[model samples]
Target: MRLRPHHLLCTQGYSGKGYSEAFVKNMDAVVHRLRTEDKTPIELVFSTDDLCSCCPDMLDTDLCRENEKVKLFDRKTAEYFGLEEKTYIYQKLASYIRRHITPDMLADICHGCSWYPASACREKITGIK
Candidate 1:
């Protein structure tokens, strides 16, 4: 499964509450698969991914209705983690997130996201051990 840079953070616990039920379900399934399937190599993608595939906002095969905003988030996340699109294991991304992305940066990175207010990602990121 491929994932956007920000999704490495988003999937830690963010609930797709405001999005479609199918989108939320797909996100949950992806997260579960990432957490359990050791064989699944989750590539770090700069564009649309498995999670975005289920979103209603996806415009084309690899585009989003809010493409500009999405790109901004993706760039910010990639820059923060010093990552480029490449094949990566889920554990490696999670480890980078825990070792580098601090609480203060979390606030800035997530401030533009609508889900940040109610999403469990804040607690999940802080509680990473």
Candidate 2:
């Protein structure tokens, strides 16, 4: 969905709010658990630190008010998994939406997409069974 329009259409993006210390810890634990459970190096990103409301987890039609877990994970845990670090901000993403960058952030965003070995490729390998 994001890729289709992102590559040829729009890709403006932005950040939401700050993260809580507890949520950060929980996210770390969750990432560990998810990878272990999936038997792959997959990380379910939390786009917000403030999970005080279901807003962060739910896809409400309204604008999301959550922190970017992907950005945080890239900074906090990618190296541990032997992955490269990447960052993105709404300001730039917003511009990307407007076709600011040549390739745009859309392609870069998938660079860290954690669903490969976890969900998409789960059946191909015996790791996640």
Candidate 3:
């Protein structure tokens, strides 16, 4: 079924209430509680800007970059895995390369986990030039 528009809480009676944080918090707690309830299983899926959550550092995105298993975890969380070789982020980077972001030298663009900072594509995002 389509999942995008489902409200975390039903707001049918209330129009004056603007963005219910209380309802959101209660809903979040309910979701966490129900997940381990054993009688019912609730599966929530979202993208990894994901692997970022598991990691303490967003500047160093290595946990997602280095281990394919963590990558697979995010995949499994989002959906059933194995639909592609490259990730959505990787593909977006590749697309950037094809367009405006020309690398000045070979070393500037890294192919694999190079053990630098968590900043995966630092130069691209920072506007260093």
Top of the candidates by lDDT:
1
Which portions of model 2 show Cα errors greater than 4 Å? 1-18, 39-62, 66-107, 110-129
* TM-score to true structure, per model: 0.88, 0.24, 0.19
Worst 10 residues of 2 by lDDT: 1-10
Candidate 2 versus the native: TM-score? 0.24
Task: Provide the lDDT at 32 for model 2.
Answer: 39
Model 3 TM-score on a 0 to 1 scale: 0.19
For residues 1-129, write the lDDT of model 3, one tens digit per residue. 001001111111112222245544543444444333444322222332321332333234334333454444334322322233332333232333334433332123233323214332334432332
Q: Which of the predicted structures, 2 or 3, would earn the higher TM-score when compared with the native?
A: 2
Model 1 per-residue lDDT tens digits across residues 1-129: 888988888887665463898998887788777777765677888889988888999988768998887788888888888888888888767877877778778877776788777678877887732
Clashes of 3: 4
Q: Write the per-residue lDDT of candidate 2 for residues 1-129, one digit (tens) a residue.
A: 011111111111211112455544644443334334423221223232223222234344322332254444333333222232223332333233334333223234334444432332222221223
Query: Candidate 2 at 72: error in angstroms?
Result: 17
Per-residue lDDT of 70 in model 1: 78
**C-alpha positional error of residue 64 in candidate 3 after TM-score superposition, expressed in Å:** 3.3
